[model samples]
Target: MTLYRQLIIFTVVLFLLLFTGTWYAKLANTRTFLTDQLESHVQDTATSLALSVSPHVAQKDLTTVEGMINALFDRGYYQRITYTDPRGEVLIDRTLPVKVEDVPQWFVKLVPLKTPEAEADVMAGWNQGGTILVKSHPGYAYETLWNEVISMTVWFAGCAVFMLAAVGIGLKLLLKPLAAVERQADALGRGEYELQDPLPRTREFKSVAEAMNRMTVKVKEMFGEQAARAEGLQERAYHDPLTGIGNRRYFETQVGADLGEGQGRGLLILARVHALEALNTERGLQAGDELLKRVALLLQEAVSGYGDAVLSRLTGGDFGIFLPHHSSAEAEIVATEIASELGRLARERLSLSDNIANLGVAAYEGSVTLSRLLSEADLALSAAQSKGANGWELRAVSGESALPMGQQQWKESLVKALEERRVTLDAQAVIANTKERGVRQLELFARIAQEDGTALDAALFLPIAERLKLVSAIDRMVIEEALRFDFRSIGVERIAVNISPTSLEDEAFRGWLHGYLKGLPAGAPHINFEFSEFAAVQHLEMIREFAAAVRACGHGIGLDHYGRSFSKLGYLKSLRPEYVKIDRAYTGELLSGENDSGFYVASLCSVAHSIDIAVVAEGVESEEQAAVLKELNLDAMQGYFFGRPRPLSSFTAA
Candidate 1:
């Protein structure tokens, strides 16, 4: 039983024992008092009656004596009254019936009242005439005892009921803190740390709560330290410590990831510090290092709003910024920003006499090798340097435009698509990492079909949709379409849908989503809502609230592109998502069999699985990679190696 229940029971039992003892004592005392009163009353009555009869007996007036006896017997107070002659013969006698009226036999038998009989001599002037006997009736005494018992029982019951209610409420309040403590423990078990608030006043409860809070703090610190260590390890592998940004290795992966067809174009801006070597020689290496950090900050600021932007220090004085989903004009904006910041830095700190900076912007359209792309950007940098310091140039390589249409045209097309529901929903199979299980779940990807019969993938239109603020509508459509899917006919039990991170922050969109989810068909797939790991980490608390709301409809939530941002993985330990998709960079390295990525995947899996989360490896392109991941105990995977994303109607496996 709960502490509250136990406390109430104990309280009631103690009250019962005390009340029983008290009632028994009162009943015994009352019974003794009543018996004494009855005995004294009978004795007094018999003596007084004998005194009155003495005059009659002395006169030997048999008629008067008989008349006085008859008058006394007429009163109902006596059960029996008798006058005996000197020879022990009865002169006058009166007695009550065997069974008295208005008194129960069982009650009398249970609490028998013995009315004592008394005898007094009826004396003549000098001789004893006869004896007068009187005994009191027990009916009145029985009635008094019965009424007393009824009153005592009713009062005891009322007090017991009131006491029980008061104690029950008191116990519940006292144990409320204990319930919170229990929840905190459960949260900890599930890889989450939930702290208790409003400490209890009770000493024992307060102590326990304090201990639990301390434990929560310690665990949070431990996870933070561990995450810091992991992130540090990651940085050492792919980041420049002094610049506090991505190193060359990381830039390479970003370039490769954005190289696929239909993946939006991006500009690689290469900025080199012109007088860094001279600054080190003239002042100190510290001054040169400070310059590099300033430039890094400027580069970081230039691409602040672009979620996919990456800044990295390739060498001591060379830095790179990759701005994805931007045109030459957009790239020029970044280049101009860099030029302005560098000019300010030179004017303020370099005495206006030092060489400032040089920037080269090279934009790519389709698949391109990192070496070739970087070389083109470098060539542009050299061309800009030919003019002098503080010069910038842009090199655009031609291919299909991620968005060939203008801003207005793009908006019109998207709005039309939304209104007409000109959208296609596709599912990519997330196969089990091992052969024991078949297909994991169907992950839905959306495409907005244009009038010309070309369906643009989200990568091609998402940025433009964001600019138009229409991404949420598209997301809603995708959700509706996924819910419309006939799960039974498709022979699938689950479907996974991706949500725009931006839309999650939209209040109206969320309200609509939850309200719409309630109307899903009975045979609809158990939907899984997915957010990028970057978004999940950024909005940890909000996502937790959203996840709870989504799960109310028997759906689940997860993170995709997990482990991409190099942010602390501590959120995973708290949010406790249903699954996590490890980005393809780590998976791609598995083919070589020499990367430390395998160890990273193992650690990631261990942490995720400890919280009952499954890990899915994205972009598994080879059997060897799959084998390595399976060995790492990966739960699932999705890529061309399994099956490429296709229209939902084309999906055959459950």
Candidate 2:
């Protein structure tokens, strides 16, 4: 029971006990007072009557005495009246039965009123002639006693009601602080530190509330420190401090994990400044550093429009760019744009050669290893340098099954695919680390079929779709297919689908998705929309609004490729995703005997777990990596080790 209710019950019991004691005392006093009054009346009446009838008794006038007694008896105030001779013989006798009216029989029985009898002598010239006896009736006394009892009960009942109302409200107000403390504790358990404001007036409650507020502040500080540590480790390990982009190590690891698994199809561009050593010797290292920073800024701005672009500083005066799901046609546009931007920089007279830089672009279809792809890009760079200053060259795949198509052709293909509903979903199981090898959820990937009976992964086509502004249409089709899918056939109750952050910017798509989620049946699988960490941070507020809306309909959101971007970890608190899937680059480093990755993963887990968020590792290709991740307290894991992506129809009903 709640403390409020317990206090209320105790108050009522106390009132009842008090009322009972007071009620009995009042009843006893009233009964005694009525009995005394009855006795005094009987005695007075008998004495007065005997005095009046003494003359008659002494004169031997029995008729007068009897007449006088009858007159008094007729008044009905006396229960019995009698006149006796000196020899103890009764001369006259009168009696009436007692009857009470206008009072309850139970009251009368509960409180029996006593009748009083009195006797007096009849004197005749100083001689006792006869005795007169009178008895009082208890009907009037019983009626008076009953009325007092009724009045006292009503008075006590009225006071009880008034007191109960006042006490109930008072207790609620006084204990309100305790309720606030309880809520604060609950939020704290979920890694949210909330303080109780406007402390209670009660001394003990105020103290307790103050303590809770202090504790919350301490917890917030602890989590902030922990997040800062993780972000610092991430910076030292994967980021280029001078340019705020990825370091060469980060680029190699990320590219290998993303592209080496036969799942990545994209273009890689390498840009090298013509004479950084000469510029440094002539204008000092500071000027050369400033020029590099400017070049890095230019590249970042050029590729900002591509959602999946990756830029990194490979070495001194050498830069690399990776645009997944892009074709050689798109690569030419990007390379020309870069050369044009660098030309403008050269004309600025920052002690640079007129050539500025040369660019080499290599487009791959995921059939080549990372080393071979880099070698091809290096050869392309050499060719561009030989061509002339500010020249660029594109080295695309040679006679591949999936040829690189132009922008217009790619757009036409994607539009027709969506129109014909040729999109297929490939699901991979994300399993939880438990005794049962529990399946957490099936993450769905979208693939568009081609005329050659070959299906292209979304990574191969989504960039073009985004460029063509057909992303919203494609996402809508994917959501429709997933919702209509019979997930229960495989006994899975939850599924996660990747959603484009760009789709959230489209107001119509957002409204339609909200409505569709709300209208889903009760038995429908709970949906978790996922967004890449980089894109999610770019459009934080839009994603936050969409998440809130969907969550109201029993849906949630998650972050994919977590820790890939350098955005602050604090956003995790603001977004509060159901889970974060760590980027596969970090997972691949498990067997490399690198202490930084382990510490970074541990800190990330601590920060996320503190806020009650689940952590999942992606790209778990080996049992060794899974063993290392399980030690880091990862809630779940995904990759080829668990299961490869397969058609949804491949699973049989349990």
- The estimated TM-scores of all candidates read 0.74, 0.87
Local accuracy of candidate 2 as per-residue lDDT tens digits, 1-654: 999999999999999999999999999998999899999999999999988988877788889989888988897777889888889998687888878889988877878878899999998878889899999978878878888888999999999999999999999888888899999999898777788878888899999999999999999999999999999999999889888888998888888877755654688999988688998999898988988898899999999988668889999989999887777777889999998888888889874677878898898775666777777888999999988878898897542455666677887888888889999999999999775778899999999998778899887788778778899999999999988888887889989999787788889998898888888988899999999998888889988988888899998999998988778899998899999999998999989998999999999999999998999999999989988899899999999999999998787786
Which sections of candidate 2 miss by over 4 Å? 1-9, 38-142, 168-210, 260-264, 281-284, 398-404, 449-454, 485-491
The candidate scoring highest on TM-score is 2
Best by lDDT: 2
lDDT of each: 0.81, 0.87
Q: What is the lDDT of residue 171 in candidate 2?
A: 92
Compared with the true structure, the alpha-carbon lDDT of candidate 2 equals: 0.87
Off by over 4 Å in 1: 35-137, 154-217, 257-264, 268-294, 315-320, 336-409, 428-443, 452-454, 486-496, 501-530, 533-559, 566-581, 587-654
Tens digit of lDDT per residue, candidate 1, span 1-654? 777777878898899999999988988888899999999999998999899989989988878887887787777777899999899999888887545556667877878777888999999989999999998887788888878877998999999999898888877777789889999989877877788788888899899999999998887676666566556657777778898888887777666766643456668889888867878889888888888888888788888777777788988788888877766768877788778777777777752344578988888765556677688899999999987658898887655443463577878888999999998998888888777747788898899888989788887678788877898998988988877667677667888888877888789999999988888777777888898887787778899999999889888898887777877777787677889998876677677664666777777776677667899999888787788888999899888888788898776544
